[model samples]
Target: MIKAKDGDFFISDWLRNVNTLEYLSAWETMNNPDFNYGEYAIIRQSSGTNTFKISVKEWVLKTNSIGITAQAGRYGGTYAHKDIAFNFGMWISPMFQLYIVKEYQRLKTIESDTLNLEWDIKRVLSKVNYHLHTDAILKHIIPKSTLPESKKGIEYAKEADLLNLALFGCTAKEWREANPAHAKNNLNVRDFASIHELNVMSNLQVFNSEMIKKDVSKTARYKILLKSAQEQLEQLKKIDILKAVRKQNSATYIEARNKTGDELEKLTSESILDKNKQALSDFNKKLKQGLNYNPKDEK
Candidate 1:
């Protein structure tokens, strides 16, 4: 939300309280140094509007917006939920309300584009380096002259999670810790990952696979890999994304133990306007050199 004239901008859920009288009184009192303390503004719960005035404290308690510094003063103004703020803006001017919506939507587009660029870089990096990791598996983890245990792919599954753990310092389950809107949210902490972190993670997959068949105990292997991941990721923690695209292509991709031909093909995307797209492609090809899946033939 933005009130350019008032020089206010905040991004969070809008606040609207149908059961309380706080909003109206607060709006009415804006910019008033001697704002009366006995005022309130309660919206009708049924209609979600139709506000009526009441006592201030009751309004505060009912709406749960009472604060240490009750009113927004020199520090711009009292903080309110986006909804309440929008309501205030509307009260201030219909033109202000439209401005708020326009500015908010514009900010969202900028945020979404920035996030997609970051995800694309990570996704592309993951693809290019994938074959290297898989090659490590085929050359080291696979049994020699024998088929390994085939009861279930759990061991292989664990290795895949290990790759994830190495790269991101957590399993997919851990990735979802906040359980953010799995798809609804377009940007997240993961979206902020650095290119260096993604690179280290790709190499770690190969390193983990190589260790799996080297008789290194899982505990020892995990510790080594985790330590490497931690130390490397430490560098990325400081990445500056004042530098950091486009549509998400409306499809989600899953991390893999192994990629199918179709999956690889699906991963390829049309180039954005970036001049470096070809370089990124060549770089990707080198990364996945030894992988079994052929991205070009993927559906």
Candidate 2:
């Protein structure tokens, strides 16, 4: 009761300032549908005079203001909307307003940093899971000594394409053909994949590894993988962090993993671009040879 009485006295004295009255009137006009503008104008006219004064309760009743409220009993005091309260704090002390704004910014930065860390952890996990999936294929899925000389290589490409089809709705080759410019620039489909897709892909890699160990048929595994991909991606889409992740496009590439014997290598964009240039030069030479052939020369 004593605190509430003190709060009422503070608010009444604050309301005696013409600027404070205008600020409150603006807040009420913006937020309260039923705010009494006629009463507000009369109050504004009489503000700043020695005889003029108003308590939180009187302000609420006269102007139908929802911005300020007076409460009684336990946990009771004069309360205002956060914006209004902040403004009132500034009216009393500028340092209080500065501290509030700085604290708000600090909390927001912490939230952003936490989200970025989560994304980096998930991306790293996906790459680790991919290695497991590849190892499973090498150990359990591919034949050791039974393959013919004609099919000596390209086993890894086929296994990778199966995963590409399940999550990306296209084989790696098909994606390359559809997006010629990106392919020419050495950009893979996974390079443009969203955070949600990468997260789901990580789960699918683990599932694939276990299925391969159990001798699951490619067709059966693919059907299950595709269904799981659709469901998981849809649910991840609804997460609020996804909006933040999407906005951060510049930081969103999954590092490419390459293996040689027992060593694992990370492929940088510059290295990929150099390879693309060499490949294009070789292709143009072969195309020129084909294009220059003439029937007369053959005869």
Candidate 3:
């Protein structure tokens, strides 16, 4: 409320201004596709006259504008969109409008910084887990003295892909083939993994290491790893703490988890032993062809 020689000033008086009506009409035109332009045009034509006046509620009802709303009760007042509210504030006091701008920007900066810090922590944890995974592979699976250096590297890759297949339901190569655009950007299957998946993968790596040390066969190890992956994912989904944390981040954890579940369902449709037999047969054919093919024997 504002004091005046006439009496008290109301927002309706400001709404009668030609400039204010034009601004509101233009804003509605740009933002609201269903805005009643004919009603707005009539309002604009009738503005800035002694006989013309419109309340916020009437404006809303006539034009279906989302920029303002009128509430009814003891505590009720008209609420305007931030843009309209800011312009109204400027109409009342330019200094107050400046303060509003500064405070809003400050709050946005703090929010952005907090989100960045959380993402960085998740990224660092993933890297640490990668080191732990590789260390486990080297200790339990890699041949030490007999294998050539090239063969040692290949063995490491094979073990890593074993984890990829168990957890993601696709080998790294298969994932790359399925997502050529992502492959072009050099992002692997794990790179797109959600925070929950990464956490589960970290645990799987350590568990697989123990299985290797116990001389567990690859087939049995995969079954155990796959079961663990599904169970841990279900538990993580139920965790309130992770849900709260993920709300601050923009990533959709539930959607990612659902996608993971779909992939696992597809993989489970086929018998694991049948798939292994097919893979082994293909490997044997490749090995036989390589052994038989010699440059000297070729014409």
Candidate 4:
């Protein structure tokens, strides 16, 4: 589009204008912490004169600007931030600028849709396998007549926490304590799990289910689950799925509802199981059947 408008020459014309320079300087100020304001001031003072001319390269070198970049190589080209690029497009013509904006929005919508579809597919697969895991638990792990109605979910929580510990190095309760803000919103650890983690977790569910059917003890099954989680996670890390997809930004969504930066950062980071000593001890005791099972207290 720029080539058709003869923008190659227009770049210098664009830079000579005081308005263009001011916009570029303002963008740099906002985005570039190390922008050389002293040099920018000198350039601004010299603006709007026939004698005043600056190339993209000259502007970058003079002001430590990051709003635009120039490189000299086969893949090299003058690139500007979207704001500056759009402004340059407007310099070409309003119609051209409109086209760029619309095309950008179209592409972004397609990208967002594709990512959402991918995430939904992964989530569905995880849910299906989770149902299978729970079914196996019902048939094999939970005793039908040996426990009361209120205690049935205790075994479910225990098995679920077993997978949680294997994959996340934490129990469900531990995850909740460490992420109180998310807990307040009724979000769980898996709700914030990355695509790769979800994929590995889906497989872990199947493995755990099969082991349960074979009457594997909790301790024995946990060792196998942990090994599989680590190995699968390491292998999945080599895949490029993370680049194409991200954990749904549920944390960011929650943060947007008047949450602070500190809480947002904490939400995004991994929660250590050992962060709360009391919770860890409780989890250990539960695993050893030392704590009374309470289905009403299910997380």
Candidate 5:
């Protein structure tokens, strides 16, 4: 159209077509309840006539249409919504439209993969920190007794909710109740936490574990953990470390790190499981040795 018109101002001519005007007006009416039907009727009546005319700017200004825009500058041109742009592209060339579709799909795939990878990394970090947190509870909070196994699990859950309340200001059950839709999707409060929150949560786990070993009261521990969470979150916001970490942990960086046999390759569920198991085994072994040894015999 521009080649035949011998100018770069063909979109205004295209916008004046009878079918294009009607379709755009109908789209506006369907999508925007506040569409100006009065002005649309005046434009519609003049369509298909030699006197009919409308620029993208005039259409937008008169009818509040958002489907198209006109700009004036060296870097500016008429821009349309993707739906309208694709239709115009098809009108211009079918092959060009097909290429646009292919390229759009490719970009979408890359975006989806990157997002999935980041989610996976954060989930893994949360889970690993959770294991360490639980280990602390087992070692310090759960008393060694012949009590039923069910009671032990209950203690663990109760302590877990204490951390949940301290960091998230709600128990797990409370979160589930408030967000039944997310609960149905198998998500929890921590799963939706921001990167900074997750970082604070990780720090809280270690801090809480140390407090547990010190035999701090649950009430006291809650205050300490909550204060730490606030302080660390504020500190994290002041720094760009999280952004740098995200870039370093990106899919491209991870792939390169894996090929080079760097430490990033160790961030796997299996590796986490093995590390937890080894830690637990060592804890139990040391417990048994401590129980068997007698310091008085050495004296």
Candidate 6:
């Protein structure tokens, strides 16, 4: 994806650094083995003098920076975690790095608000829908005579997988394969699933639970569930994306002000991440539901 190569910081020589070119290349290399390495290596080692191998082991030796790395083989390339990437970004261009940090911080500011709003909304909606999925599960998963709390817990886990499969288009293991962008190779779509998808997932799990009892095969259920998820996403595409983003942004600002209808400044007084940032993700979801979302369908 990196058609251009530029170094902002030198892992060894302070003169070289990382930038957008590095981030994109690293992402491509990790996801696409056939990624144009001949093109990328030049970029990876483009530092005029600090051509140290991008190996994690090598980097530690060179700069004592414990993070940032270069991997090799069909599934390897240079990668830095967010912290290291921030360092690399600064190393590449001080102002550019600052901008990167600022923009990223902005995104996170927005995203964290989004995440918290999502968490709260889930807490609210789930309280009511918890039994919808669980009741069906209890009947299907338990023995007729007696049911234990432990057994109900087991049933929930299975139902959760079914939910993962429906909206995520993958089970837990499958999501990692599809999204190797993980810091730990364990990325679940739930980690970043659209509020709409998560909402639909709750409904799907119940639907899937019922389907399971009807003796539908897993493959059939998977196909049906995926179709349902896609259809739901498609239905929401009727709205304008930019408009939705702005509307949601406004709602987020207000919620942060209201602090989810609680004491605003005091409740989140210690958020070191974003000073005076607000919570509006639930508003985003509230507005976007049946109107817009799920990037897979956005395009």
Candidates sorted by TM-score, descending order?
4, 3, 5, 2, 1, 6
Report model 5's TM-score to 2 decimal places: 0.61
TM-score of each prediction: 0.44, 0.49, 0.63, 0.65, 0.61, 0.37
Q: lDDT of each structure?
A: 0.49, 0.65, 0.66, 0.71, 0.64, 0.48
Best candidate according to TM-score: 4
Q: Cα miss at 100, model 5 (Å)?
A: 5.4
Q: Could you give candidate 4's per-residue lDDT for residues 7-99 as a string of tens digits?
A: 355677888889999999889888999999999999999887778888989999999998888888999888888889889878878788789
User: Model 3 over residues 1-299: C-alpha lDDT tens digits?
Assistant: 24322445678987998988888988898899999999999998888779999999999999999988988999988888888977777667767768988998998997777667657756765665565565655666664524444333334455565677767777655666677777677666766776777788888878888887787766677778878988998998887544323533232122112224345434432312223444444443543464321111111
Poorly placed runs, candidate 2 (over 4 Å): 1-9, 49-51, 71-77, 93-95, 122-126, 131-200, 209-218, 226-299
RMSD of each: 13.8, 12.5, 9.6, 10.4, 13.6, 20.1
Model 6 worst lDDT window (10 residues): 250-259
Whichever of 4 and 5 has more lDDT, that candidate is 4
Q: Give the lDDT ranking, best first.
A: 4, 3, 2, 5, 1, 6
How well is each residue in 6-95 modelled by candidate 5, as lDDT tens digits? Answer: 336467677778878888887787788877889888888887888778888889888888777888999978887777877676656668
Q: How many clashes (backbone atoms < 3 Å, residues ≥3 apart in a chain or on different chains) does model 2 have?
A: 0
**How well is each residue in 22-110 modelled by candidate 6, as lDDT tens digits?**
65455555655545556455645654544433445443344333235666799976666675556555655668667986897898888
Q: Is candidate 2 or candidate 5 better by lDDT?
A: 2
lDDT of 2 by residue, 188-299 (tens): 6676677777788888888988998898766677777877888998898788654445633332222222222122111111222333444444433543464421111211
Residue 89 error, candidate 4, Å: 4.7
Please state the error at residue 234 of candidate 6 in Å. Answer: 0.8
- Candidate 5 or 3, higher TM-score: 3
For candidate 3, the per-residue lDDT at 78 reads 82
